[model samples]
Target chain A: MRVSVIATAGNIAGEALSNKSVVMFDILRASSTISTALANGCKEVIPVIDVEDAFALARQLPEGSFILGGERGAIKVTGFHLGNSPLEYTASVVKDKTVIISTTNGTKAIRYAAGENGRVFIGSLLNCSSVAKALADLSKDIVLVCAGTRGKFSLEDTLAAGLVIKDLLKFFNKNPWQAKTQEHNKFYLEETPIFNNDALILEDAAVAALRLAEYYWQSPIQGLLDSLHGQKLLQLGLAADLDYCSKLNHLTNVPVFFNDKIL
Target chain B: MRVSVIATAGNIAGEALSNKSVVMFDILRASSTISTALANGCKEVIPVIDVEDAFALARQLPEGSFILGGERGAIKVTGFHLGNSPLEYTASVVKDKTVIISTTNGTKAIRYAAGENGRVFIGSLLNCSSVAKALADLSKDIVLVCAGTRGKFSLEDTLAAGLVIKDLLKFFNKNPWQAKTQEHNKFYLEETPIFNNDALILEDAAVAALRLAEYYWQSPIQGLLDSLHGQKLLQLGLAADLDYCSKLNHLTNVPVFFNDKIL
Candidate 1:
């Protein structure tokens, strides 16, 4: 399980992610919101980068069958049903409805990772362990993508990545570096990747993520609050959202992107 | 003072480094070698990106007065005076001599940083404390550029950057966030800028660096050895250079880049 972490989707080449299963994180809200909404029975999520695009997608969906979601500057976009807050994504609110969401950073990341036929899974503190377990089972090289704030590194997303990486480290302990051949073909489908002698190589960014998350091993809320985006949200009177986003392993289901929708 | 860390010089816009002081770190060997040479009484070090440029610069200087030093794939370039090994830069060999060095990543980063009229300094674990103190005293926004291995994030450089950031955190303890206006004018000159209420902000990448370094607070050598580049260097029979580069504050002299030369 060789892993490389990209701090932002803004700088990565789509082809680099072609052979890797990408774990997309936007913990200040995107990942957490996606996980919460889907877990609450939201049918599917169509992520688009621009607000106009989201509205177009929403309009195309059958009326009363879809909900407008996401935010701009941490506040709910005008005419949208909800903001990027996980607390608003309750069963009563999103049940059996499609969510056409657009966010500042999160959805943009999902779109980028989904490019070049990438297998994308959305992860956050909410489903940290579940995501790790899924990836360990998948047995392929991984790229943890943090959807940073306006192309800048964000602490919350990295922490979420680190949490998953920490789990992967423990699961693959003592494994030392050899690239897996026929790697991509057997990675995603029903076939399990078997290794005679495997190495769990972590590149620099991956190692950095693990180290930072380990430092905040016991207090994830502190780590989230320390992030710039988190601080902005807190100052905007969204402490409840921060508290919700910081929960560790609250969900056992890992959200995977498939055919333009996160299911 | 606000600080932003560029994980590598590869992705940054050179203008972003403008109006700020730049601390370049290529801890594998480039930075450590430069600081060692300067500390050992080398007259000045000229950093150029290409071997051809090093030779061209050498031709521009008097013979026997300067030496060519650098590496390609961690080995001494053909006919070059030395490889990228800090242990070889003893006072006997480099003392009072001008070194026109070209390194794969280090000099490339130096050239990029120097492009936008930025004040640049070279730092490594060897002069970590000195660089921190110099930046603290400078009282301006800083961009720590890590000359990562082939434009990928290198653990050793981030660790070195973290060490400097940790010091700044201590030096400006309890200071909160406020951007300095007329900032560029007040910075880099003899005129000291006074702040009524200043903020010591560490952007996300900067904070991540501090956390990772703090995790290895008591085991820097282990951090270096764990780094991918560090491991590669060790495999290439350069453990001594690794040991030399990992020494914290081994030299108090902070080498400053002035008029295309580090002195």
Candidate 2:
């Protein structure tokens, strides 16, 4: 099975990944937030590219059945129920509501991939290992699509994509695409030495898992709450349940986005 | 002094380099070639944004007294006497010649900075240290304008800019603008370490400088010379001179472009 990791959806020259298994990542919170919302018993989360679509979706959902959430330039929209920060969501707020999200970069990237011809999965560092496991289990071609910042390659997004690549490498010898992507990642990783800069990789992972677990352990989504995307959620006051979501493998529920809905 | 580096010319939000010191880097041969042409006895090098403008400028020059040279996708213009590789402008070729040159990205960047304020010095790895010295001497304010890949930040250009920052730190404490630019570059430098892995610092500097020194050296611009941009140049048959232009600090000449000509 061939597996490839595209740096970003913007650079997809001429529909290259049309039929591949595509996992999209927006680790600075979009995918993580959606996963969190669904895990916390939200019926569904609809992503829109712009503010108007978000407003339109909010109007269509049954009255009092949904909450509008998302941000532009890291700030909440006026009068909206929420902004993009993941830390604000709690069981009291999202237990039975739907979420309408509109973001600057992530939603646009998601829409672009959804338009492509393939099975699509929402990805984030929070559930990166799980997504990699899912990719390996399928034993087919895959493309890790990073939702970079504003139509350009971003450092944070690329690092999360690297996490997926690192996990998938445990299961298979890298194909040419995988090799190039890995080489590309290895280049950057060597520069910062950020991951291994401090002691105890296990401790760091454990703490990250714990933080996520604290937020949404029982809600279903777990482990992702510790990712870079997850931290941003904490800032937004959206997912006060972030600590519960950090527990690694607590729910075993892998939320997969298919042709339309996520299951 | 406030010193800021524009990550890419595309991201220049306001006035570009007005009443300030700005260094422009098109390290993959354009600025390096221009530097060499000026240093090696060229009478003048006129940079035009489009090929038509170059032709127009050439026609205005005295008949048979000037030369036309440059590349579109790294290849020589049809029927032109020279290509962009700095090595092609040895004493026999460019000395005493007023050459008209245009390239895909660099010329556009130069033209883009044409009307803006401040002194503009063409930058390259070949003149990295000297450029730093020049900036230190000016000691007012500085902006490093990266001639990025098609108005987007590419690894090579940003890294070269970082190299400039690293050198500049030796002479002065980073001012507020330099601090911000450094912060921005830290992200890109950390993200593209593969381009610098295991390579000696001087070797890395020379990698982009050697383009002009290519005929002087026996090798070609080896090792991943075929990138999206590099391949464009190769397809135009401009690949052979890449090695010469990629060398570091080979041309101690710093061609200052202000008003219109390379001084």
Candidate 3:
């Protein structure tokens, strides 16, 4: 299957993502937070584009049934129940509650990708392999959308995308189908997956992302600490969030965003 | 000596490139062609933002003293003297003649960068080291502007920027300053180059560009041939131009664009 990657959500147009499976990555915090909340038994997550929308959605829900969780400029929004840190999204806090969230970058990306009629999956280093396996099972063309920081390229998001693409490639490589011969001694093709030599096109951004992943694969935490946004978060006293987001394959829910909620 | 990279010209605002040394990279053809023409003894190359401006500038010049050279959609402009290929800019044709040029992407980038009061330099793989040396000698903050194809990221331009940054780092690494001792057995500091530790900050895009250059340092030609733009040129039967642009440090003339002319 062909896989393409966009370095930021601002680079995507509505028509480009039509009829494709899209995986949104914001590994610095948002995607990881969403995956953690879902994996911890949160009923659902409503990702709104703005803080006003989050408050309005929360008000509409039954009292005490939903919590407002979001951040602005890497800090918890005024009057919000929780910030974007995945550490705060534990089972004891988020269990059986619907979360109406608004983030600076990640939720906006989800809203943008939700414009097209495609299956939208939340992806991060926490559930990269699970997301890759889910996409492979669909056997459709995939587009990895990186929720970069405020319309600019972010290293963490791009590296997470690269990891997803690399995992997909490895999955296909190790699970190649084998052909069997019949009693009549006639050669026949077995039921194989979609494998076209020319169909697997790699865009320039995708290649760059893959290279970035390879370069920092051995020390992802240190790589995150060295990134531009990572440094900003460090200045904001969010080192624990960085360490939490650095874990690979720590979650397996493979959260999917559908009908304004991540399930 | 901070270095920041913009993946595409669209990301740049009016104030972003002000008071900096701006190096524009369109390695596939436009910047390469401009450097080649200047190196081949052309009087000057005027980069215009539109084809109409190119034609107007040519008409204003004395007859037989100038030539209109440009391309639209990878093909030579109608009735122009040359296309956007460096191979077409030989000494015999462009020597002592003013070239009024416009391309689909490169000239637009030059125009955008020229809006601010920065020193604009035309850069490509052909003159990467020369451009890096020139910037290092100036000791001003550098901004590498990639002339991405039609508002999208192009691989060749980013890789070329990375090469320039890599060379500049090497130049500084090898030429460290030495202190002198006075007659009274006291040490005196020499006039060293700008060496502030925090001043040489690398943005995320700049770091990515550096990593890309390191990944493809050994096989630059193959790297170019494998780029998205390179594949398009091959389809258009312009592989020869790709070969010409792939040569690293082959030209020493660092063509600087000032006052509407590349000299």
Candidate 4:
């Protein structure tokens, strides 16, 4: 298996993405929010690129069927029902509701991945293990897309990506491919067919992420606190949000982007 | 001052690069090769992207005035005088002669930086301290361009870039900006005017490099040996070359791309 981590969504090569499965990490919020909403029983999360588009999509849905969500400059958009905070998404609030979301970085990456990749999976610190398990099961060439802050690399996303890579290595080491294929045929036909994991090769970007994860494995929150977006969120009194996003492998749901929605 | 480390030459934004002092790093071994040639009394090194262009430029130069040098798949060009090996460039061989070089990655980044940046500098393990000193003197925004393996991030160049950024941080901590501006007036007026380094800000890409540097500080060679390009070089019995490229702050000559030549 070959894995590549794109440092930022801005420079993603569209042609290269189509053949590979993409897992996007916007650990500061978007990925976390979507994952949480889905875990809490949201029917689907529609990631739109623009706030206007989110509004338009919401208007088309029945009044109680959807909730307007997302952020601009780390704050909830005016008239939106919820902000881009995973903590804001509760089981009672998101149950069977559709989330129409737009965010500064994550949604753009999600949309790009949606258009370019056949399999677009959402990941964050909250659900990285689950994400890794799903990817390793497919055993296809994968690309981890980091929805970087304003077209620049974000440390938070890279850390989450590293964690996923770390977990993937563990899974590959513990389970033989022959064993995995027989047991996990759940999405084999619809998505990628299983391939033997004889060797796992990580590209340079992925290597960097894995190294960061190893370095900060002792105290991952410190790394998040040191990130550009994390610092901005801290300044905006969203330390709790950062804390929420930093929880590792706490969620079991993998919100996969299929047919223009994350479910 | 703000600093950014571009993971690869492929995704460099032209507009952002123009105002920043771009430092190109191709650790194994274009940057190291150029630094060695310059330190050994070469007149100049002209970096061209294509082998055909290198041949065309060499043809234009008077015979014996310049030597055609560079590599394709880590080997010297068929008709060139030297390969992309720093060890090949010694005082007796290259003194008082011009080097027209082309490489798989390094030269392309050099050409792009030359076209876009007002000031283009070369860096590697051999001359990272020199590069950092020169950048600190300028006291302007900087973009550390890592000429990655093949349109992807290379760990060797990232580690080198990290070493430079680490040194830059040291320079800021040890000396006041006002003092630096007084002593280094050589390229101040012609290029970027010195600014106060009261609080040097590093972009996220730079932060990643710095973290890598900190992680590998005790065993820098191990990091290089672990890189994809480094492994390939080792397989070809270029272990000595990797060891040579891993030397930190061994060279004093800072190669600057000025008026079409790295001098």
Question: In terms of TM-score, which candidate is strongest?
Answer: 1
Q: Which candidate would rank higher by DockQ, 3 or 4? A: 4
For residues A1-263, write the lDDT of model 3, one tens digit per residue. Answer: 66778878877888978878899998878899999998999999989888987888878889888878989999999999999999999999999999888899999899787756645899998988899899888888888998887787787888888777767776666321111111111111111112234546567777678777776665566546546788778668777787788888888889889877899
CA deviation > 4 Å runs, candidate 1: A174-197, B174-197
Q: Model 1 Cα displacement at B218 (Å)? A: 1.3
What are the per-residue Cα lDDT tens digits for candidate 3 across B1-44? 68888888777887977778899999889999999999999999
Interface RMSD value for candidate 3, one decimal? 13.5
lDDT of model 1, residue A92: 94
For model 4, the TM-score of its B chain against the native B chain is 0.88
Give the poorly placed runs of model 3, Cα more than 4 Å off: A60-64, A171-197, B171-197
- The lDDT values for all models are 0.80, 0.58, 0.79, 0.80
Ranking 2 against 4 by DockQ, winner: 4
Candidate 2 residues lying further than 4 Å off, grouped into runs, are A1-25, A39-41, A48-68, A71-83, A88-97, A102-105, A108-121, A129-154, A161-263, B1-22, B50-56, B62-65, B135-153, B171-226, B231-240
Per-model DockQ against the true two-chain complex: 0.28, 0.05, 0.19, 0.22
Tens digit of per-residue lDDT, candidate 2, span A1-263: 44444545665554756666677777566776777777678777777777987898788878889889888877887767988755556667777788778887777777666655635778765676788788778766666676765554333444455456556655654331221222322133223211122221211111112212222223322222212343344446535344433333333345666555555
lDDT for model 1, please.
0.80
Docking class of 4: incorrect
TM-score of 1: 0.90
Q: For residues B164-204, what per-residue lDDT tens digits would candidate 4 score against the true structure?
A: 88788777663312322342222222222122224687777
Error of 3 at B118 (Å): 6.6
For every candidate, what share of the true interface contacts is present?
A: 0.47, 0.00, 0.36, 0.39
